[model samples]
Target chain A: MTERAVCVIGTGLIGGSLMRTAGKAGRTVWGTSDSPDTAEEARADGFDVTTDTDAALRRAAEDDALVVLAVPLPALPGVLRRVDAVAPTCRLTDTVSVKVAVADHVARYAPSARFVGGHPMAGTAESGWAAGQAGLFTGAAWVVAADDGLDLDVWADVAELAWACGARVVPAAADEHDLAVARVSHLPHLLAAVLAAVGAAGEDDLPLALAASSFADGTRVAGTRPELVLAMCEGNRDALLGAVDDALGRLGAMRGALASTGGLAATVNAGYAGRQRWAAARDPEAVRVRRSRLALPALREVGRRGDAVVGWTE
Target chain B: MTERAVCVIGTGLIGGSLMRTAGKAGRTVWGTSDSPDTAEEARADGFDVTTDTDAALRRAAEDDALVVLAVPLPALPGVLRRVDAVAPTCRLTDTVSVKVAVADHVARYAPSARFVGGHPMAGTAESGWAAGQAGLFTGAAWVVAADDGLDLDVWADVAELAWACGARVVPAAADEHDLAVARVSHLPHLLAAVLAAVGAAGEDDLPLALAASSFADGTRVAGTRPELVLAMCEGNRDALLGAVDDALGRLGAMRGALASTGGLAATVNAGYAGRQRWAAARDPEAVRVRRSRLALPALREVGRRGDAVVGWTE
Candidate 1:
């Protein structure tokens, strides 16, 4: 197989990691950052880096190459405009979490480029080039947006990049991507923030100190960057609003059940069943992989060596 | 310190752990389980165990020991009734999560005993004798509730037991304990279960597979025992209902703000600030202690070492 040339614009975590992974996969990789300092940092970290958008775009415009837009949502239009000027013939994709606005903008501004709105549903709270990891997208989902007149080979190349990075590609329309993320991602962040607010409202120091593993787990996403959350919510307002309403409606129904004479048991049973179904829906392999990666080697070894014990009664 | 003779009536996670911790602290500990198999297991595990409720209560009455009702909320009244029949003079306490209904029931049924409602805000998802750990309550919060006439020394003894298990005792009314837990614990579980339902509702397998650390963290509690969750919600119906309403109202307001023409940035900023403030409200030392205990030693060591370099800026 011929190796593809990959150009990643914006040398942040997503961009840098894509360049590194593609390079490791024997692809010719070039990357660009906003500033000279970041560009130098990326180069020092072994990425072929430039500060010039046109140079990066020109590199992507070459034969059998792909361009990745790994910048923030707000920066996408400008980046696409640059790509239009310098790499009009190149196949383009993105790593932005939100897709609706960016998809509309790309359709309007860079009609000539073979644009596929993509979101690798993976990341940490940490950002910047230094936080880049080669296996960051491994076993993650890369959503490829559905659009009209999209080239099959270009889509295949994009999907191949995701596969090479060990991500599972899921085909979706831009609106579906927006809605799914709003339900799973954005709404969780909002709920976490609200939980935090409630937790902080009281003056007692004991309750806060008494907050356990569940509290920590539930509020983890509340620590994410406010600006980014705001951007996603703003950029996909309709979808997020709908998801929020859906969640609240569910919560209201639960509350109503709790208030009724027999409602408490029914609500609790629903919650219990919901949890079981949720756990079943989760990928056991992914969970096992993550647990192995995060746990101490001793624990991992014990788990590996342990004999399986099963009770038939259950 | 006088070695208090304590009789723990239940061999589950809470009871077994309490027995071990109490034994470790040089207290004379005796435990009983409802099942013969559990009693045998507890005995084999080095706990003094019995299956005869009357014999266990007789022992408690003879020794004037503290009686810990560590059974489920639904089982509390029956357990108290049995205890009243055998050890009416003993100072009674419990480790139930929901307090209001249990307290009221005990007040009416076993009013002669100095019944102090207690909740040790600590546990793992695992239950029964094998799952018990000596350090289960370490760095946890123990909430104690009593009527006006309880002896101060008995209260102190209970507090001391909590302290010996490496927990900080927080005094609260039974009603207050119920309400507080409803907000912090019950509501979060409900939210997690509902969120999991939403994620499961999606047809594409990508979302579940692509779910990251954030998703896992948020949904951890949703995978716990549905029976226990249902019991808590059922037992503390009013409080849980109130908490659900509070949470939904806040979430609805946030959704409305995001949906409005005024833009989502301001609302999201407010949430961001709210989360930061919430995190700040926690006692750092307590958090560190708890995290160290739960996480692997290597991760704990990393946290310890990193504390010097990365002071929590937020």
Candidate 2:
């Protein structure tokens, strides 16, 4: 049996890392980059990277390769249009931060493509092909769309690719994935932004001067590039807005409690318990099933139960 | 002249670390712990530790030691009372998280002591003497009181001790220090708690399962002991309330902009700029002065300019 091929479009951190990871797993992986400099650098690093997207899509279609859209949200439509023109029935997925938007773009621009949206929850704040490396996805949760009536074969292909990259496959609906990430990832970014701004507004630089590990940890992601943060927080506007509302409600309650009772035992205790819950679920129980008998709803249920797909026996 | 003797009350993480640090710096240091287990452990670790608070205070007064109160806010009053009874005129300071409250406690209990409030802005989530180590204050900021009419000699003693412990002295008034920490330290704890709670409330454990570095970083401090968090935050109620109001205002604005304009460029950009400012001031310019020539207002102005005291060349 031949290892499935992977065609990645984009050579940023996520895309480039996927390309390296897939190739290292002996998959026939190649990538395309819009930036000539990025393509040259990846090629110089001995990866098959090109500036031509249509040719890559054509080859991917001919070879029945998985076409992973690795571009930012703003670049999605153009790449999807090329996929439509060159490989309308290709096995398609994406590495975008948000999932539902990618699914919508594929429906509009490449409706015939077999799309299984994916997002590998891994990255540093760095960008470009140079920052890409193998094992970037090791131990990370890779979300794959588990919406109803999806192509199980293509979903399997995407999930297997994630597995080969050393990631645990978390089957979730596109909308659910977006909301979950908004709560965990995007909301943290927004909160970090607000905390950093408030801490910086202190008179006499005293706050920053006395800032310790807690302040540093809380604002770590606020140091991420502004454009990238904007793309993430803004791309999932509805979900993030909801998450923000939840956070604001919590903060408002905390403020009220602090102001009225001069105490926040309830908030602090709840947070402590929440943190304990996260710690307890850090290494979730592994769920295994045969790929031949894999049911989408059942797999989604495993994810819902805080279990990760660690194996799919043949 | 020989190094001034040091006496520490409350042998917890901060206190235990100070005992080791001062001993290593060639000062005659001793500490008392209310917890017999903690005192026994510290004594076994080759330091002079006892469970007798009054005896330690009496010796400190006899030896003209700089008495350091390293107790939590709740234990502060009882320890301060001992200082009043046994060493009312001794050189006094503290390592409490909140300065204003400790100052108030000192005024109400041990008013005649030559007191100069101090707080080392360094610690871990772990508590107790077993978690303590030498050099804990290395490269950290140790804030010393610079309120009007402070005993400059005792202030110099506290500042010199911080220097010996490998920390830069940040001269700030008690009220100013409380307000500043309310922004940097206490407020982050609250935000982390709120964030942890919000993230944990996600449906189906999806958010926790998909939590990544950003979520982990933002909620890192939420794992701290709730009692410790409560003490620090509640101890500085007025200042923390003001800080919480500021944060809530920013979060509210972020939610409004994200909901209406579907854009948070302003928030993200401002946060990025704030993070940049923090990075710039990380290794502040060094301010050196002779101990004799150091004026209280001038030293505080140095701190206001984000400069750290690195030397006191005679």
Off by over 4 Å in 2: none
Tens digits of lDDT, candidate 1, A1-314: 33578888887878888888888877888988888999998878777899998977886776547888998878888888887788876888898888888878888778888877788878887778998999998767677665555665666677667777777656566776687787777777777777766655555443454466777778877777887677666787888877777777777777776676635454445555655655565443321222112222322232122111111111
The candidate maximizing DockQ is: 2
**What TM-score do all the candidates reach, one by one?**
0.85, 0.98
Q: Which candidate is the best by TM-score?
A: 2
* Stretches of candidate 1 exceeding 4 Å from the true structure: A146-148, A283-314, B146-148, B202-210, B284-314
Please give the range of 10 consecutive residues that has the lowest summed lDDT in model 1 chain B.
B303-312
Chain A vs. true chain A, TM-score per candidate? 0.85, 0.98
lDDT of 2 by residue, A1-314 (tens): 33789999998999999999999898999989988998898888999999999999999999999999988898889998899999999999998889888888889999999999999999987887888899899999999889997898898899889999999999898898999999999999988988899889966788899999999999999999898888877899998888899888988888888888898999999999999999988988888778778798888888887788987775
Instruction: Give the alpha carbon lDDT tens digit for every residue of B15-90 in model 2.
Output: 9999999999989999998878888888899999989989998999899999999988988888888888999999
